[model samples]
Target: VERMESISRVNSSDHVAACQRSNVIISLIDEKLKYRDSRAKDFSAKCQGLKFLPFVTKPAGFSLNWKGNYFKMATMFSAAELYTVEHQDVVCLLKPILNENSPSFKGCGSISLAVKDFLGLIRKPTINLVLNQLKEVANYCEDITLYQENITNACYKFLLEAMTQNEANKVMITAELKDCSFILVENTYVDAAKVAFHLNFEAAPYIYPLPNKYKNNFRELFESVGVKRTFAVEDFAKVLESIRQDSESKQLTENNFQLCRRIISEGIWG
Candidate 1:
């Protein structure tokens, strides 16, 4: 019985030591798994082109500093995904950025269109105030991680519509008097593809040509609207260019341009 008891004690000590060894192995495995996951996440983020704060990045093709080409020619794009919970927040976050030169934003078409729609709804100081407030909110959203979970396409569309409709009061067109001058400056000779993109026309999937029939009418339309016919004191081009320098002149030109765009978009002029 004494011998049996001694042997049992030795066996129990072996079992305890074996258990300690097993625990050490398990701990090593867990640590290795954690390290692997962290590496994978970093790799995924890099592959997705996730930047620090601003997600916008132009293509590598535009690296060459050529003077003649436009800055947005290479297409600086943003690929921000919005979540349902975060969609409204994201729209709210981006409103100020969207509002600034919105009609000219070649990056995000939806945001630009939404801003245009919002301005159509909300007019003057009130819209201007909200836009100003949006500027404050736009300063945030840096904490948002690129690969957010639970994001759906529907949520994104919903956010855009809601934010757009939120400010639905239209602006007042107080004055519409005699004549406003505008310049159709075409310094850079770009093809139809580039023109379609700059104008934000339906050039996706395929760039359909502007039908030779409409091409002649296009020139006639502008001429009918009236370009300055040569002035003695200031050159015709310089007079139009001068209007662009003043804030009021700038606004008037924009208003006229918008009316022209509307006529074309609505097919009313055609």
Candidate 2:
């Protein structure tokens, strides 16, 4: 009996030691899982883009910069998305960035269209302000029903009819546009697609380093819009040079030069 008791005690000691090691391993695994979860959350937040803040009244100061192109591009994209949500007229606001001599060109002295769209003129609500106004619209137009009723313009009659479809359709659309109540406010002075285009173009140099799937999706956004899938600026001088060198060009008269120039310009710019 004495020998049996001693052996039992030894066995119990070994079992306790094994349990202690198991506990330690379990704690390490738990910590690793928690760290992985935290990292995932941080990456997700970064990818979701910037959240704009609402302003009660126009502030006395505003500024935006090109630091951290990823987040900056996301924030600008959010602003542009908000602008589109409001269904504002985009035609009058868009000016060709290549046309530097035009009076309406807003690039200051730089040729970068991204700079012009984001910086904008002092008088206009720039991209930063557009982001702020997105929040303002969210704050004021919380109730989609009431917001829809307030649409009084004759031109927006079709839009209103679309908004008031069957209950299920209305619910779906309201769910989509609920965050874009600012679309008709006439606040943005730049085209949303152009803003998206130039910003994406500027960020192109950095995009190759990203994962293949992410890079593909980032590029696909522009294609989903009517814009083509290229960020390259065609050289008009090169086109002219090619035309001059063409054998068929020798018979062309100078009177047709203006017409040819207009057609070539349309082919390139349009």
Candidate 1 residues 139-174, lDDT tens each? 323332222111112222232333345333211110
- In model 2, the Cα lDDT at residue 236 comes to 35
Show the lowest summed lDDT stretch of 10 residues, model 2: 90-99
Model 1: weakest 10-residue lDDT segment is 169-178
User: Over the full model, what C-alpha lDDT does candidate 2 score relative to the true structure?
Assistant: 0.29
Q: Provide the TM-score for each candidate, comma-separated.
A: 0.15, 0.16
In model 2, the Cα lDDT at residue 225 comes to: 23
What's the CA error at residue 123 for candidate 1, in Å? 23
lDDT of 2 at 158: 32
Model 1, runs deviating above 4 Å: 1-84, 88-130, 133-168, 171-270
Candidate 2 matches the true fold with a TM-score of: 0.16
Name every residue pair that clashes in candidate 2.
86-183
What is candidate 2's CA lDDT for residue 73?
A: 18
Candidate 1 residue 20 C-alpha distance from true site, Å = 33
